[model samples]
Target: MTEVCFVGDADCDLQYELLSRETAREALSTYDLRRPFENAIALSTVSLGAAVSLCNDLNWYVVRFVDDVLVREPSVDDDEWLSRELATAVRDGDVTGPDTGEYLKVYGLEEPEPTPEDPNPKGPPALVEPLYVSRQDGAVPEYDLRDVDDTVVVRLTEGEFTV
Candidate 1:
């Protein structure tokens, strides 16, 4: 099954509870992240920005953001170390770490399957459509998420992630 996670607006204390869901939330949490090998693509608002800043800081590839997707094509050769460093930077909230040199890899993919509307699109459309919260519960929509490719999507719980 595709793995996923979700991130919501949370305060400092709330962040802890949120992280707890990282492993427990359904195999597919609310967050939908793409594999960083098709070309190190970032596909969310925060991650996209992180990718761009990482590229600029490390002189890696030019990170491109088309809608919610972010793409970085390594500008230099042998960017394996660079990519790993960038990933660390992103995880640690540092673009240029003392341990990680100024470089990034071009491992993430640039193009995913194309939807009819976004032809030759720079990136795939948003993973989660606007949430349709319903006070009345019976009409909630559902998605099977059985056949998605190269993606990890987390499921949601009673205001939490189950893993």
Candidate 2:
């Protein structure tokens, strides 16, 4: 199966910006998946066709995030639900919300640097920032699957497909 993950440096480089549910809904609309990604890649054998389709759909947002990521810099909208539930939290002097670390771990990913000494870093703080990921559920890909895939890797039998 196609492992849905932020596997590469390129994907990690994409700032982990958590979109508000409404904002994400809008983003989804751009792709005609106005609804949640109700699709599934087979658990153990993702077909080439499914991978191609998912890869293509994900590529569009990758481009979009690269272009507009900075505009929503985390210093302002760092937390996940704040944009929806706590828009005035910062201005009202309330503690905002979670950071990059708390968010990325949910996806079994982590960004070691939450803040850098550069004083003016180049990209989003690692792990703490929730990067935009295309998903099979509601806003931001939620691994809220009912049946988690088996942790054990399954290898094909040596002669399973041989004549």
Candidate 3:
């Protein structure tokens, strides 16, 4: 099976923005209706197709938020659930949570950078500023995983696929 991630690049040269969860959901819905999912490349293709559909709908004339990618100047909505999920994962110690160094070591990914050689690195930064969380009043939380102190890596593998 192919691996899928919520990887993104917010400040690329192209200058696109991230969408809130609700907007993304709407995009997903439109994508679902526009394209029929196939088994050949389920996750990756579907995400790309949906993103393209959304772009076509909005007339953005660019690429952004396809699959687990965030190309261009992505600005997520304050009330998006994925943001919360990421926060919870970090706080609850999920696999894709914090531990930037460890994430890089395992997946060969890199956190976002001003001039990144690899946009889709194995590891990514856990917390970013100006995230636009809905409940901005409360002290915004970061990396509240099960063991905030521990570091871990979780991968999905199948026959003939070893990393």
Candidate 4:
């Protein structure tokens, strides 16, 4: 299965925005949605091509409400995710195998703080700003932007590497 995860902009309510719009809602009607992170929505597709197609189908809404589009194809790497552009490239045969691991965007997985009302906070982790890095010797550096319980490493194509 290829999973596509949509991370929303800080000010947007991603779920409501996508589900409320007729076109976006229609495009997403077939899949079961999952929230793997705060302000994010995820769905699974049979293959990388289908995942890219789904993203393309929702591009209008994605551009307006989404901050990031991440795709995970188990055939590539089960532990790391791929940027939408990279995923598209892979599906289109522009990238393959170990070449996919060269550039990366590492995001910190920050857990919500405990509050008086909810001491033991239990919600999806918030993804922090991504730190773009290139892989060296088959490994990328640890995320050091902030304190986080974990990190999500997203592979990127050369075109999508901001830094």
Candidate 5:
């Protein structure tokens, strides 16, 4: 299965923003939604092609409410995620799964605050600012921007590399 995760923009409540609209809601109706991160929503698709197609179908809402779009294809790397652009490239056969891990955007994941409504947190950790890095000798550097218990690494295309 290919998992697609949408990180919400800080200013908006992502779930409400997407589900409130009829078009976006209908487009996402078929899949089961999961909140993997504090401001994120995730869904599974059968293949990389399906994941990219769904993202393209919801581009309007994504542009307005999402901060990032990440896809995880088990055929690629089970632990690491791919940027939306890279995922699309892979789905289209422009890039190979093995060649997708050179450039990465690493986001620090902080522990979530326990809320009164939901005390026992089952959601994934919250994401912080991402640090762009390139792998060297098949090893990626640790995220040093802040103190985080975990990190989410999103593989990027060379064109998407920022630093």
Candidate 6:
């Protein structure tokens, strides 16, 4: 079972509620997301088409939408993004905190399987852009998060992140 949690979109109070089917549905219906509920991709297998649908539907960038597993090779841009993150982690070292290998060891498979030379290369397309919410006019979507109960929503609180 593939799991996905909203990574960005912090300003949208209902984002935390998006992890649950019932709550996600309620939030989707209540908000003016402009995208159809039929297209939402939270907690799903995350097919390439589904990734595209979620990214395009939510006006998200191709990297913000993350999945629990590596469903396919990341887009060139996403590969660069992950590389930068890895560089920063290596620079940070134990002095910075926990080890960062947890990410790269698992996700980096840039050298596609079957080597593209194999007559039987079977899998997702060679290049895949991750699903992500785009930057909205260079500004974060601002919304009041006071109404939602903390227990029901699972997300980092406003203070836990730097805008």
The best candidate in terms of TM-score: 4
Q: Candidate 4 vs. truth: CA RMSD? A: 1.0
Error of 1 at 52 (Å): 28
Choose 1 or 6, whichever is better by TM-score. 6
Using lDDT as the measure, the top candidate is 5
Q: What is candidate 1's CA lDDT for residue 157?
A: 21
For candidate 6, write residues 1-163 as lDDT tens digits.
2222233333332334343446335533533432111122333323334433343344323234322212221321222122223322333342122222122221112223465479566432221222222235533232233222111111221222223
- Model 5, 50-74: lDDT tens digits are 9999999999999999999999999
TM-score of 6: 0.22
Tell me which of candidates 1 and 4 scores higher on lDDT: 4
Candidate no. 3 TM-score: 0.20
**Stretches > 4 Å off in candidate 1:** 5-119, 127-129, 135-138, 141-155, 160-163
Q: How much is 16 displaced in model 2, in angstroms?
A: 6.1
Per-residue lDDT of candidate 1, residues 29-147 (tens digit)? 44454534322233332443444443344231122211122232232212222233344344456533333322211112224566799666564432332232222332233323333
**Model 6 regions lying over 4 Å from their true place:** 1-4, 9-42, 60-163
- Alpha-carbon error at 70 in model 3, in Å? 14
lDDT values for all models:
0.30, 0.27, 0.27, 0.93, 0.94, 0.28
**Greater-TM-score candidate between 1 and 4:** 4
Q: What lDDT tens digits, residue by residue, belong to model 2 across residues 1-163?
A: 2222222233432323313334433433333211111111111114323333443445544345432111111343322222211223332445333321122212222223336566544432222222333323333445443333211111111122121
User: TM-score of each candidate?
Assistant: 0.19, 0.22, 0.20, 0.97, 0.93, 0.22
Query: Looking at model 1, which ten-residue stretch has the lowest summed lDDT?
Result: 1-10
Error of 5 at 106 (Å): 0.4
Residue pairs clashing, model 5: none
Could you tell me how far off, in angstroms, the CA of residue 53 lies in candidate 6 after the best superposition? 1.0
Clashing pairs in 6: 60-132, 60-133, 60-134, 61-132, 61-133, 61-134, 65-131, 65-132
**Please, what's the RMSD in Å of model 2?**
19.2
Please state the error at residue 10 of candidate 3 in Å. Answer: 7.8
